[model samples]
Each structure stands twice: as structure tokens, then as C-alpha cells.
Target: MARTGEFLMALDEGMLAYFREMADEMVARFGIPRAEAVARINRAYAGQEFEPYPDLMCHELPEYWAYGLYFKPNAGRLPDDDPDTDLSAWEVRPAPPAGSPAWTLEA
Candidate 1:
């Protein structure tokens, strides 16, 4: 993996736990297996750019990430099937300022 990839993969316990919770929620809500739920989450996030760890954890909710923030629902799924879900309204929160505490990690 590249250095950027390595850095992204180096999530702290809190971030790991957050993703675990997201997968678990996906399973419970969507009635999908754990592996599939995780795959979906990965697919949703693939090629997307954002901060990890404290930065993301601080500003984003797991449900937003798990459900509609990045995931485009063309696969016939629960939340996707729901006619009332306004996916168009979902948006990623603004990123923190460059020199803020959210970017204070040491190299």
C-alpha cells in the first residue's frame, strides 16, 4: 500500500469501533450479513476523500456514512426501497479548517 493508504488504514480504536457499529447497524437494519454490510460501506467510501479518525468522528454520524452520505442505492435494498427517503438532501458536513485541532496529528 502507498503511504497515504497506510495512513488512512491506521485508524484509532474509536474509529474502528465506529465503523464496526456502522456495519452492525447495516446488518440489523438491512437484514444483510456482516460481510456484505462491510463491503457496502467500503464500496460507498471508495475513491471518496476525507479526513479519518478524530476529524471524521468529530463531524460525522455513522448512520450518515452507512446509509446515504456516500452510498448510492441502486441495489434493491430497504432504505433504498423506501419511497420517502430523500437521498438528495443528504450531504457531507463541511471539513474543518486546515490548521484546526482536527489536523493536529504528528507525522
Candidate 2:
């Protein structure tokens, strides 16, 4: 594992826990099987190189919505955006499934 100086540690147990939680949320919200969700999550972080600050891992699900997992120091504060409206929350949420009419809305 390359050192980032900020925290010279690889994906440790805590990071794995966060990943697992995110995966489980994906399964519940997206109704995808556990194995597939886990794979998607893995792919999101597979080739990602470490950064001095937190790393944001993102994966596009079957639907139009995307999943983002933020890996950072717990002691440090995350952004203060409103959680309800913010899609970048720590946990993934369910969006309209694929083929839903919501996708056709004009931006």
C-alpha cells in the first residue's frame, strides 16, 4: 500500500466495514442480489489510487442513480450539505429502478 502521509494505511478493517455497510444498503435499496452489489462496490474502488484527503468511490447502478461511498477519517467533518437533498450522503438510497418514467423527464 502506498503511503499518503495523511494516513499511511491501506483499506483496513474499518474501511472494509464501511464498504460492507454500503453494499448491504445497495442490496436493500436497489433490490439487487448480495453478490452483484458487492461486485459493483468492488469495481468502484478496484483501481482507485489513494489521495491525501478522503477518497470518494462511486458506482453507477442499473438504474440512472449512482452510488457513492466516501472513505475518510471519522474525526474529520464531512461537508455540511443538507442530508435529505444531498445524494452524497454516507449511505446509498433507493432511486427509481431502471426503465422508470422518471428517467424520461427533461432536465
Candidate 3:
């Protein structure tokens, strides 16, 4: 894992694409403006605790559940979870405190 600034700057292309795809899907499905969708995605990343496992990423939308993203060890690929699903139906949960174990997972 690199420094936060460096990690973001050097983000894997696939990872960045995944983020963008998710954000775009949010915009199309939820009717949010592009800027707001992008901001929400950025906020999700910014709100995460990366110190424990920098490669593991977690993002939470308040009262809207959370999700994890990471390359499976040695597989070099992301999981096939459906990011296109309508997440609005999910129960809302408060965002976990920074550094909380709930937001940390082994990469």
C-alpha cells in the first residue's frame, strides 16, 4: 500500500474504472447528476479507513449500507457482484466511525 496521496495517484486502472462504472450506474439508476454521483463515489473512498489494508476499499453511503472492493489475492480480479442493482431498496445503516473494525478487512 502506498501513501494515501500516492495510492490515489497510482490507483490501478481497473480499480478506477470500477469506481467510475459504479458512479455512472448510480447516476443512471437514481437520476442523480453526474457531478453528485462522482462526488458520492469520492466521498465513499475518502470516508474509508485504509490504514489496515490499503488495498482493501470500503465505501458507505449513510443509511444506505456499505460495500467492499478489492482484488482477490493472487486472482488479480474483482468479484462479480452486481453493482447495477438498485441499492435504494437496502436498509440504511449509519456510516461506521473512522478506523472502526466494521470498515476494515484483510485485503
- Judging by TM-score against the true structure, name the best candidate: 1
User: By lDDT, who's the top model here?
Assistant: 1
lDDT of 2: 0.42
Model 2 error, position 34 (Å): 0.9
lDDT of 2 by residue, 59-92 (tens): 3222222134322223454323233545344443
Residues 1-107 of candidate 3: C-alpha lDDT, one tens digit per residue: 23222122224554455455665665555565555454444445654433332244425332121132211122332223377754454443233344543332221
Give lDDT tens digits, candidate 1, residues 11-45. 45566666667767666654655655555545444
lDDT of each: 0.49, 0.42, 0.40
lDDT of 3: 0.40
* Model 2 lowest lDDT segment of ten: 57-66
Query: Which has the better lDDT: candidate 1, or candidate 3?
Result: 1
Where is the poorest 10-residue window by lDDT in model 3?
A: 63-72
Rank order by lDDT, top first?
1, 2, 3
Superposition error at 101 for model 2 (Å): 33
TM-scores for every predicted model: 0.48, 0.40, 0.39
How many collisions between residues are there in candidate 1?
0
